[model samples]
Target: MTNSLPTESELQEAWIELQEIHETYLLPYEVKIPHVDQYYETARSIWLAVLFYYKEEQVHKDVISDVCQRDKPGLARDQQVRHLKREGWHLSGKGGYHSLDPFQPSPEWVTERNRRSGRLGAADFTQLKKFYGNACATCGAKEGRPDPRYGQDIVALQHGHMDPAKPANDKDNIIPQCQFCNRAYRSDYVFDDKGRVYAVADVGPVRRASRQVQKKIYEWLMSVFG
Candidate 1:
């Protein structure tokens, strides 16, 4: 519900500790942090961005690029960010670049401790479904109708986050999605209310394509659908 940013004091402490780790080159949980440069570069900037913007906002991809992009030229900024989760950075996508601050208790943790404590109520969920015509907002799979992709007799819909990365459990941030969508698609790409793939963080999901070809595809999409 609330966004958190690292304070100046926290950043200062992190910087001091960063130097210590760099000198010692110790790994936490047997995970290597790569080579740390006193002057922050691509990897360092990414870690810093995720930490600073944790728990609410997405890490700014453009700012990360501006700071340092010494990695692959073909890699998109969001793509660079997605890999952090593998490195034990708690991040989420399929909406935008979102992160969970390790220091903070996430909505998941809270809900585990107390069910529906900060989630949408049944009344709000019903209203949301009605607004979207009791159908999957992304695929138009009407509730009780046969599944579109699969041959199920009934397509049950559930409360799905508009941006799964953020903790907006309100109706505004929710939509109806079938179980197939909620789990299968997950948050690989951010979808519009209409269920269109509006934003993609990584090209891997789209498969490997040259940068030039990808640009053309983007232009074509914007021209035709933007």
Candidate 2:
């Protein structure tokens, strides 16, 4: 027996087969495998069981038992468990497990996942700008002009969630924020009654152009003191 895990295509086929099995025998009835002490109802649990069974043929009984018993057993088992849990399985009873609910990502998770995948493309940015009208929600700065002090784009809008904890890609949840305001808000800055944003703590002197300024200073010193 080989220790190799199934390919993605094989895993997908196995998942489909597991789904079919779940629908046919598990969904309408409470089915339990004899000597296994675990229910195989949901597609996720069924898939895990199948994956574990496949590995059982390749590995020692002690290894399988350890994997089934411990939470963080080893790399292979841990990976399988994580995959199953992500697909909505949960450990249950004294031994083995069950998938209680289907996988449903929170809005925040979806938004983060989309961000990671670069799914918020040009069209999405356009829509965001159109919705918010190219101004920072906090400071009301218009888009495209450079910051006077930083020399960075002041109004270059950034996507930010109204509620960072429950972030969503929806127009209502997202807003166009200026780079300064975005940074300020992220650093726990709060607006005063006069609408002036203040940082929670002193951030020390603002950073300046280092190498360019140094070169310019050197040139000025050479021209003056030469």
Task: Tell me, by TM-score, which candidate is best.
Answer: 1
Model 2: CA > 4 A from native: 1-123, 152-154, 187-226
lDDT of 1 by residue, 1-226 (tens): 1123344455446555544543353243232354544334345544553344343456545544433444324435544555555544434544444454443333343434334222243357776676667888777888988885797668889877677666757555677887778777666667666666677644555566687888888899899998
Candidate 2: Cα lDDT at 183: 75
> In terms of TM-score, how similar is model 2 to the real structure?
0.27
Report the lDDT tens digits of candidate 2 across residue range 51-133.
Answer: 53453233333333343333222323432443433322332322343232222322343444445433233257666565445
Report every candidate's CA lDDT. Answer: 0.56, 0.46
Model 2 worst lDDT run, 10 consecutive residues: 30-39
List the lowest-lDDT window of 10 residues for candidate 1.
113-122
Error of 1 at 101 (Å): 52
Highest lDDT scorer: 1
lDDT of 2: 0.46
